[model samples]
Target: MKKKDKSHSHSHLAFDHVSFSYKHSDKFTSVFDNINLTIHEKEFVTILGPSGAGKSTFFRLASGLEQPESGHIRLRDKEERHRLGKIGYMPQQDLLLPWRTVLENGLLPLEIKGMNKKEAREKVLHHMKKFGLLGTEDHYPHQLSGGMRQRVSFLRAILGGNEILLLDEPFSALDSMTRYMMQEWLLEQWHEWDKTIIFITHDVEEAIFLSDRVLMLTHPPIKGEIDEVNVPISRPRNEEHRSDAAFMKLKQDLLKKMRSKERSL
Candidate 1:
């Protein structure tokens, strides 16, 4: 697939020469070293790499869950020191509170923002049908299927009111068929919501199917620029696109790259 030219697009989020390290035992181990990355407005970008490749760390720094040891993280081209509530984040696990009803869980972000209880409930209810969570409002997380739980988690993330969403392998735990369905549903939601999505996934096909571009993070202690490939498949993609020649070729290429990196480790 040819790399898409993103030179003209507006930068929505950027990591400007950011450096970060983790404290382990008595020493600090580098995760990212003077790395810079820019995600354009409304673009869906996927990060793929082996385990411990700093993928989750990238999300943490981008979402401001963790601060860089040096350099700046910017959103909308403006550097902000504190950015937690400004971005929506969905972790690998659905992380829905087991005791909370679907409605209660979906209202968490609005609640945190001090929205009126009645207004927040109304807002959550309004999107219930669209999210395929209408009748499950009173059900606890434990009562819902894995896919249903994830839908609730997704609803909660968007209600955070952020235009940029960071999703860390959200479908990894689902069955294969369910995962595929969720990917399709996610694209529909992305189109309607018009938000920039930065997704992390171990699945090459998922990355190609869902992203405008796929970014590969080398092993930990990553430095300089990240390797990337633009997804050539056009938007509003369907299941038939998966069988296209370009899609198969790209999948093989990505798998080869990932395997080489894993072998190096």
Candidate 2:
């Protein structure tokens, strides 16, 4: 189940025969079994699954926050198994420090890397404008909208300076209108940053709208190959695409496939 690609550009992230589990008491809860996949540079990939399907577990493994029981999680810049800071990660919650201002929070990653505070502030300020957080730099998380907090969280991940990002339902908590706006803004940022991103979400429409391809965790304790659906619609997509025939068809198909295990949970 191991995948090897020598191509310098497309093969930016590789999950080689990765198997993982969580130990609970005397029993081991199986999460993944021999998972193999490759995420290309600048590609946006979303993961979808029913509740309790281990979507977050995969993210933990990808982010190097937890180790797989077996197999390799390799990045383009390295060959060994150590990953750690090679990829930036954002969790479901904004996880912004309420005590810190937006700009200061975004600069946490840089500071952890021993970067100078003044220098990091300058860099964060420059990107804050692009993220639409320019005038709100001094505002705390509690003072901003939900969408604004997420933008700050994303800014923190970006400041980590990894070409790959792991996001776990980063926008699921916002209201419908705010979620839509965040999605549009995130897509714009993705296009501009040219970074590879792997996202986890339960929302079918969000997965389809945001990803170049969607991976469905069809089988739990899933082994070997998994279901992957490519978005046929072109990029720079707008709200109109949701009404397009191709989009609806793909949506229906993916929904059907993903719902197969819904009743089990």
Taking the tens digit of each residue's C-alpha lDDT, what string does model 2 give over 1-265? 1121224556788888989988988998888999898888878889998677778888778777788899888787355455666879887677899999998898899999999889999999998987778999889999998778877898898899888889888887678987787788788878877778898888999999998889888546977876799887777878888789998899999987767655454
Best by lDDT: 1
The regions of model 1 sitting more than 4 angstroms off are 1-7
Would you give me the overall lDDT of model 1? Answer: 0.88
Task: Candidate 1: give its CA RMSD in angstroms.
Answer: 3.1
Deviation from native of the Cα of residue 174 in model 1, angstroms: 1.7
Model 2 Cα shift for residue 84 (angstroms)? 1.9
Candidate 1 per-residue lDDT, tens place, 1-265, comes to 2233456879999998999999989999899999989899889999998788999999889888899999989999899878888899987678798889999999999999999999999999988877668999999999998778877887888899899999988888778987888899889888887888999998899999999999998698988887889888887888898999999999999888877866876
The prediction achieving the highest TM-score against the true structure is 1
Tell me how far the alpha carbon of residue 124 in candidate 2 is from the true structure, in angstroms, after superposition: 2.5
Pairs with steric clashes in candidate 1: none
Provide the lDDT at 38 for model 1: 89
